[model samples]
Target: MSKELRSNFHEQLTEIRDGIAQMGAGVTELVPRATQILLDGDLEAAEYVILGDNEYDAKAVELEERCFSVIALQAPVASDLRSLVSAIKIIADIERSADLCVNICKAARRIYGHDLDPSLRGVIQKMGNQARVLFKESTEAYLNLDGPRAAALHDMDSYLDDLQRQFIQVIFESHAAGTIDLQVAVQLAVVARFYERIGDHAVNVGDRVRYIVDGWVPEHPYAESDNDPPEIVDGVIVPAGQS
Candidate 1:
């Protein structure tokens, strides 16, 4: 490549990286804001989170366009091809993660105007906090291209799965004992499921980071059990088995 063309390519690559980082920051903020809305039972805050989803969508679209431009104009190959591919994939994951936050906020609004048992609220809030931390760490790993840090996020997600399982058991126990209203138990179950999914998406970002840097997809770090684990026969885990 000519020096001028190389320089342009590097600049475009930098812009893509910066754009991803900006989107990551925006998505990261949504997690806490959505959780706060849930904790405070604030309808307005929930609405704000729902509206903000569009912002993330727009950013993802912009990043996708940029990646397409780089591929078409620069004709990247090998590692550059991997980086562009990873950027495209990561944007989708990031956008979905943002959407999950919006969904959580919507759920919070649905549960608003009703008095939730404090114990259930406590559990949901704790799960939200844990998810937010994972989101932040996973994005940081992506921005830094730190495979080791990205690898570590899988363990954090495992903690989230354990929390979700414990919360599910609590809900079932409460329902069986007639301690929690069935409707409330169901709502809490949905909330727990959302939190678990958020953790999964964060792990996806980590996997994409590995793909970009190492040109290989990593196994899902959050698989529940060794027995009957999600099939990762090759580098890529089968989507069907991904929780």
Candidate 2:
């Protein structure tokens, strides 16, 4: 490749990376707001989160198009190609995560008037905190290319799953006691699922981050690739759960 062409491709690549990073940051900010809105029954805040999703969606679409354009125009191979591929996958995960937040906001709308059982509310709030930490750490891992740190997220995710189930059990307890209406219980269940889904998406991004930094896509069928991308640093550097 000519010098000018290589420079231009690098610039485009940086822009794409920055775009994904910004998207990650956007979601990181929104997660806490979504959780707070849920806890406080803030209908106005819920509406804000719901409407903000469109901006993130537009960003996702633009990033995906940029990735495809880079592939077509630069024919980036090896690490350059791998970087773009990982960006595409990461963007998808981030977008879904943003949707999950929007889903939480939607759930907020459904249950705003219902009084939550105190025990169930506490557990659900903890789950929200866990998920927000995961989201923040996952984003940091992506921006820093910390492979091992990315892998560490799965443990916390397992814990998040357990917390989600506990929240549901509490809801069941409330329902059995005739404290919460059936419709309200179901709505809270859906809210728990949304937060749990956010954790899943964070773990998905962690896997992608490891792939980007170490070029070692895990033994998952969906991640199997034909290209012989260059290997960097022998082992994965998974990011652990952050405070």
Candidate 2 steric clashes: 12
Runs of candidate 2 exceeding 4 Å displacement:
221-243
C-alpha-based local distance difference test score of model 2: 0.81
lDDT of 2 by residue, 108-185 (tens): 776778887789779877988899888888998988889888999999899999999999999999999998887777
C-alpha displacement of 54 in model 2, angstroms?
Answer: 0.9
Q: Which candidate tops lDDT?
A: 2
Compared with the true structure, model 1 gives a TM-score of: 0.86
* TM agreement with the true structure for every prediction: 0.86, 0.88
Question: Over all chains combined, what TM-score does candidate 2 have?
Answer: 0.88
Q: After superposition, how far is residue 180 of candidate 1 from its true place, in Å?
A: 4.2
